[model samples]
Structure formats: C-alpha cells, structure tokens
Target: MGYTIKDTRHLKNILRADFILGGLTAFTGLVFFRPLEGFLGLSQPFIILVPLANILYATAAFTLATAQRNPSIPLLRLLIGANWFWTLLSVALLYVHYTNVTTFGLTTLLFQIVIVGTLAYLEGNQLEKMA
Candidate 1:
C-alpha cells in the first residue's frame, strides 16, 4: 500500500531526529576523544573514527529526511538495520573491553545501546505500520 502524507511526515521526523542525534554524538566524540580515550580505556583511533562515521550517518539521515518524495523503504530499512548493528556492536565491545572499561565508559556505552536500540525498534514499528 502507498504511504499517506502523515506517514511521510512521521518518517521524516524520525529521520530528522536521528540526524540531530548522530550529529551531536559525532561532535561530542570528536571534541572529547582524548578525554574519552583516557576515561573509557578505549583507543583514540576508535573514538575518533566512530564519530567520523557518525557524521556520515547524520548526513545520510538528513538527506533522507529532506527528500521531497515519500520515504524510501529500502533506505529506511538500511537505517534501521544500521542502528541494530550498532547496538549489537556496542554490546560486543562492552563485553570484550569489560576487563578495562571504566564505570563511566560502561554507562556511556549502555546508554548508546539503549538509544540506538530504541530508534531501531521505533523505525521498525513504523515500517511495519507503513507496510
């Protein structure tokens, strides 16, 4: 079935929210990489690189959000998939680094996982509704 205008708007809003969040995360990570590295017991490259990727993700999200047509289902699925992937990776990272990760780092990672997982769930639910 075709999407309604309301559905498009809702999808756009969700993507826009993701864009803002990704931008913020990238900014914070880039700005505090050194401090984060020291506090999180994670490498500086990992800290720097993830934020760079976040910027790219934000860009894509912004583009998708501003699209003139109905939202692309494939792309939306990709975004949701990426979010889930990120959430899983974070959990794995937390497990791998459990020996060295500080409490602050653990909390930060957990927060990220929760946020991303929620976004994924929300996006997936919207997709199902659209379907």
Candidate 2:
C-alpha cells in the first residue's frame, strides 16, 4: 500500500482568508454607495457608479485568490496584480475620504490595511513554500 501526503490546511486557511477579505471589500463598497450618494448629492447614473466600483473590487479579490491557489496557472499573475491594484485604489479612496472629513474613513482605512497586508503576507509564504 502507498500513502499520499496532502496537507491542505495552509491552502484552506488562505482560501478562507481570501474569501473573508473579498466579502468585506464587497460589503464596504456596497455600503459606501448610499452615503456617498447623499454626500455628493448625485442622481441617476452617477449614484450607480459607486456600487459598480465596489463590485469591481470584489471581483478583483476573488480572482486574486483563485490565482494564489494555483500559482503556476497562466493569467494568475495578472489576477494577483489586479487584486493589489484594487486594494491600493481602495486605500487611496479611503485616504481621500478621510482627508475630506468623512466619518469612519479612518476605520475603513485601518481595516483595508490589515486585510490587504495579511493577504500579502500569506501570498509571500505561499510563494516561499513553492520555491
């Protein structure tokens, strides 16, 4: 009889973290829409844009996680880049919002930093193991 080693605990943790981050990003993006709209007092098509931005960020995070799981997979690298891109964009947006005296921007910025920073750490660990 032959035994196989399939220790996927680390992978599972990565996936769980990614999922949580992705969900949070999506939620934040969605929640910000209403207040942003009221603050900006925008109407019609403009109001919808905020939610779309959130959805895009969520999509990027999802794709990034998929790529992390299979590093060797073609296009995974691109997805990873996209993930970081959106995260940084979100950070910048938060910074701007806070600078303009928007409430909770500080909290959002902190959460974004922690979540994205943790993802970066996990990604580094995965890459180290693969190497």
Candidate 3:
C-alpha cells in the first residue's frame, strides 16, 4: 500500500513552536555551559570540552529548527541522534550529582528532559513522514 504525506499547512503552529523551543534549548545550553567551572568544578580541559559540546548542541538545534521548516535533507536524522546522545550524557551527570543535587542542577536536568522529550517526539513524527 502507498502512503501519503500530510500537508504542512496544518502544522504551522507545531512548526512555529518547534522553532521557538529549539532556539530556547540552544540558548539555555549555551548559558548553562558558561559557568561550568564554578557550577561543576570542572578542570580546564573539561571546561573547554563541555563548552564545545554545548556549541555542537546549539548548532544541532539550529539545524533541526531549520530542517523542520524546510525539509530538504536528512538533517533531522542527525539531529535526533545528536539530541539523544547529549540528553543521555546530561542525564548521566545528573545521576552523578544525585547524592548532593543542587537546586540549579536539578532544574537544569528537568529542562533537559523536557527538551529531549520534545525533540524525540518531533523526530519520530518526521521519520514517520519519511517512511
């Protein structure tokens, strides 16, 4: 049986919401990474590396947001993987801090969960469309 692609016109709100959420995710990631040395007591090497990861995440969010509006390539697939990887890493860190979880850390962890969940849902819908 053949499948049909739904019109994106009806998804205007979703599209818009994704764009906004993606931007927020990117911005928050950048903000949270800035004071990593103070917040996480990271060494120089870790401070450098974590910021790089944040940069990559921000870039991926921007790419995903763009792809959501204009489906030209398989960028969303890359985004899905990147987002999942980052989310997993962040969750791991949160788990590490579970013994002495700070308010800031807990709040950031919750935000990451929300953003990852949203990205997962959007990516799944996009993949279904492709199939």
Off by over 4 Å in 2: 1-8, 36-72, 129-131
* Clash statistics: count for each candidate: 0, 0, 0
Please, what is the TM-score per model?
A: 0.87, 0.55, 0.59
Model 3 per-residue lDDT tens digits across residues 1-131: 32222444433334445556655644654566566545644344544555566555556555544554554335555656766786787688678766555566567566867777666566546544433
Candidate 3 at residue 77, lDDT? 57
| Candidate 2 structure quality by residue, lDDT tens digits, 11-112 | 445645666666665575566666755464334254355356546545644554565344342333344455566567657766666555334545655676
lDDT of 1 by residue, 39-87 (tens): 9888899889889978977887888799888777777777888999999
Residue 38 in model 1: shift from native, Å? Answer: 1.0
RMSD values, in order shown = 2.5, 6.9, 4.5
C-alpha positional error of residue 3 in candidate 1 after TM-score superposition, expressed in Å: 9.2
Spell out the clash pairs found in candidate 3.
none
lDDT of each: 0.83, 0.52, 0.56
